[model samples]
Target: MAGRGGTQGKSGDEVVERGGERDAGGGGMEGWKRKGKRSPDSSLRHVFPTPSAFPLFLHMAGSEYGRTARDVLVACLALWSVTSLVVIAVWRTSPGVRSMERCKAELHRARGRLEEARAEWGRRREELQDLLRKSAQNQTHLRRQADQLTQSLRNSDASVSRCLQGRLTYSISRYLVF
Candidate 1:
């Protein structure tokens, strides 16, 4: 039974492999045949087309008929002058230019204010740190004073107990004698 199953699997794989190969070859060859039939004529027609009127006009304009180099320089200078005048006019009349100037002024003021604020904050922070250090020193000093007071109170309590015990012993001796 195992041998029969192996043979069936091999036959199924062969059939699928053959079908895939046929499909791939048919698609590739059909595209190639269609492109090969149209490419040569189309490429030749586009590459060798006759010149039109617009191209002729462009050629005439680019050619120097009788104009001197000085004339060309003068023409270029005039064009540049006109272009600069137009640009200056636009800049002076445009609202965006004025808005940009206002924004720059406002930005400068904001930067000045920010610097002032940062300086003030630094000063305040230093003051706070100094106060904190002083507070810590005061706390330490108070703690030391409290410890000294506690020690003195303990010594005084010990002395008072000794005096009381001595008085009690003296009284008991006198009574026993009587």
Candidate 2:
């Protein structure tokens, strides 16, 4: 008879022995076999003491509790996934999130405006420098023209004075000769 701690060794209808016990004949393989057959009640009595202990056995054989545990695990995982998704959605629609997005957009616009202003300043500076250069060239040209005009006026005045004096001297000589 197999106890609760030992395995039954043989197929049906052949007498199964417990823990490979030897028969009285002491034959090697033949003694191991040919043990008297036992009833099903006697075999199961050593495994389970009461009828309620059957379901309390190991759950590794695809029992009811095994399926229930798997279902519970899946449900918990699904609940966690839904909770995380809700949190993310709520955060995205929050006031702080919207404010942050607005600030980012404003910063980008400000940067673009600053760049445009810098470029305009560069162009205006170049135009001012060109105007200043042209103004200096014009002043130099006008000074040269004014100096030439003054020299011409002085030469004309000297020639006119000398001609008038010579005419006056000739008239006086004519008068004395007459």
Candidate 3:
């Protein structure tokens, strides 16, 4: 049932996984197709993997001309199929060449998203640091202003004491003369 090892081909009549892929299932031709069917919502269909460029070769091979073609044409298809199989095998039993390309594209997109998130986080952190620095500077300025006001009040008190002493001496001297 399985080819080379205990693993079986996903193309077996068992429909692989019905409509959707099990989380632990390995990659298979049928698994890829069924994964798309799991969703009922049309909008969600966009979430499923699209047929990659790899399918185009298979589609062309299965065309009407493919069947009625001459011996040379059949030979060509056989060669194409063999090459396709080799590419898929070397790539570690993936669906097909096109599918792998799609996977690569998706990975690139995910990398881009990660980079964007990193940039956003860095920007926010910098903003927070700046705000904290400004708050500290403002607090220091207020403390300096308070110290200056307290010193000015002390000076004003000393001046009032001297003025009162002068008035008292003048009044006492005038009473003695009377």
Sorted on lDDT, best first, the list reads 2, 3, 1
Runs in model 3 lying further than 4 Å from the true structure: 1-111, 172-177
> Residues 39-66, candidate 1, lDDT per residue (tens digit)?
1122333544564643333223323431
Candidate with best TM-score = 2
Off by over 4 Å in 1: 1-89, 170-178
Give residue 15's error in model 1 in angstroms. 99
Candidate 1 — what's its lDDT? 0.58
Model 2 residue runs over 4 Å out of place are 1-79, 163-178
- Candidate 3 versus truth, CA RMSD in Å, comes to 23.9
Minimal lDDT window, size 10, model 3: 1-10
Q: Residue 158 error for model 2, in Å?
A: 2.9
Pairs clashing in candidate 1?
Answer: none
- TM-score attained by model 1: 0.46
Clash count, candidate 2: 0
Candidate 2 residue-wise lDDT, 4-40, digit = tens: 2223434534332322354454422344334443432
